[model samples]
Target: MTLFRESFATQQSLPPWEARGVQSWCFLFPLSATAIQRYLDEYFNFAHPEPAPFRFSALAEAQFGCLTISYYPVIASTNKANMLRYGPQTTSWDHLSYNEMYVAAPVLCNRVTPDNLLVDRQIVWIQPVVMCDNSSVVFATREIVGIDTMHATINLRPGRAPGSLHVDTQFSGFKTFSPTTAEGPLPFLHLETGSPLPGGLPEAATREDKAFLEGLFGVIGGVDLVGGVRPTTTRLISLKQFRDAYDLRLATYQAIVASTATHTDVSDLRFFDPKEVDLDFMWSASAEQILSSFLQLGRPGDEKASAPHEGPGWDLVGRQVKIKVAFAYTNNAVYDQIETLHTFGAE
Candidate 1:
């Protein structure tokens, strides 16, 4: 929300920091890397508390401008993935990581601002992820996130498409929590000022972005969005992908609760799901494409909106797109999770 630029943008980057603030607005202290390691390993693995408190050292708060709202420590990766849904089969996938924070707040920057304009007044921070056709990953040291004490499953009835003959879905889901264990700190990426994106933030807002920021407000207030951290993005899974993955995550969660509760089948049970497969996709883009292809008028997929000067598929593809749509989910209970964490119908 705030725009910041500074005199010393060129000398802004801190030596070591990665704690990212989502709409949460979290920032890190200038601790030694050794101390930071201890914090991450020993003391930082939980959600934030009510009022969505700001986490910052006095110096950090002064430097970054806004008090951070919330942060993701050790963010493995933050980017968007989108799958085009078309064709008779309606066979496609889309997952946008509303999980990554938009670094709208101020901090260090690599470049100095124009003297007359402002230094560190504001710098957009962008994650220049590889093209949608490509992606990369970061593997951090794996650690066990804590388990909850109670969980409840809700059954969802199916529905039919309006004026049509397509089956919707039927499935089950649950949310568990350990209310006793309060939240802890997180370390995120402190991208400098003057990066890119409007007002020097990272990615632009999409549907998932709206869901995440709104849900985050509730979570920080101690309501437990889904008995856990709400998912950071939204998803569009095929009906089959929904049924199949929901079954898997539920099964995995069931086994986890069973073992944590009684430890009776700890040996017999195991977690099984493919990693490295696509589960989520966001709709973000690089600076060039965002400008070049974005339609100044009309809907994205509308052929009539395509100008003759533009080439093939130009109107149908690119950023800032919206359309009238209808979607179905197994039910509303874990619908957000289906959008965020469920991993069926992966690419």
Candidate 2:
């Protein structure tokens, strides 16, 4: 069993008040410490490099990004009004929720001008992609968008990689089998799970109270610092494989909502797609990056993607490329565990 109380609840960001706006905030999963560590050592290390700046690492901290950052208020009588600018307004666990795993950075700001000019004193946080049983099965791949909450029209982060920009991402998907289990099926891509998130899945999750299980792990936790998430893609799943996974997920979701009152239709169906075949696009995150490269694995117009074999598939591309898996984080050493029976879901 895993401990899911306060120990898993609240954790402080290390080296607080980073001027560059980069702080290593904790991701408290309900999983066990050992399981997390093993995944980090055996699985993740195999896929990415250790502290590799460009591939998987924490968001690179810039020089003097913030004029000042503070976790506590200091008494500055002469500059009393600006005290809030130097300190964190709230360090309590209110940013957390029982419905989903917490994924947020320590970001706060203060005014610089008298009209209370808010310069970079703004912050943006992309809420975690919580799992939900009520989630409708979306055909789209999983995506993590970081919006500029501070500025009305300015929150997209671009990268040197292909496709779009400003997508500060960390991979977080669930495994089908328990790491503690002797050995079972390889874990499938399972990102959402729980009683139901606050608003429920992303299209997000939630509820008044009750507990559920969920796993939140990222593939490229630090792809931001270098080459912009070289998004080392690897999973080579087929259409049939994806459909099977989708079926199981749909069934699980229906069952959850069935127990609730009049769910009518799938108005509350979870929307994100967390399957192997869905993402893996080269342009995508690891999941997306995988597909883009894998597509090159076969010739063009090949209806289905198959490794090199005498099959009626893409006539242009040739060969079978296998994708590998190992969870990687931007920051190398800091790892944690979540202990729980909660399935990847929402409240």
lDDT of 1: 0.20
Candidate 1's residue-wise lDDT over 141-254, tens digit each? Answer: 000111111111111122132221111111111111245533221111111111111221123246754444343333223533233222222221111111136555432221
What root-mean-square deviation over C-alphas does model 1 reach? 26.0
- lDDT string for model 2 (298-340, tens) is 2235344322223221111222222111111121111111111
Angstrom error at residue 152, model 1: 39
Model 1, which residues run further than 4 Å from truth?
Answer: 1-216, 222-301, 304-347
lDDT of 2 at 142: 18
The reply for model 2, stretches above 4 Å from the true place, is 1-116, 120-123, 128-130, 134-303, 306-347
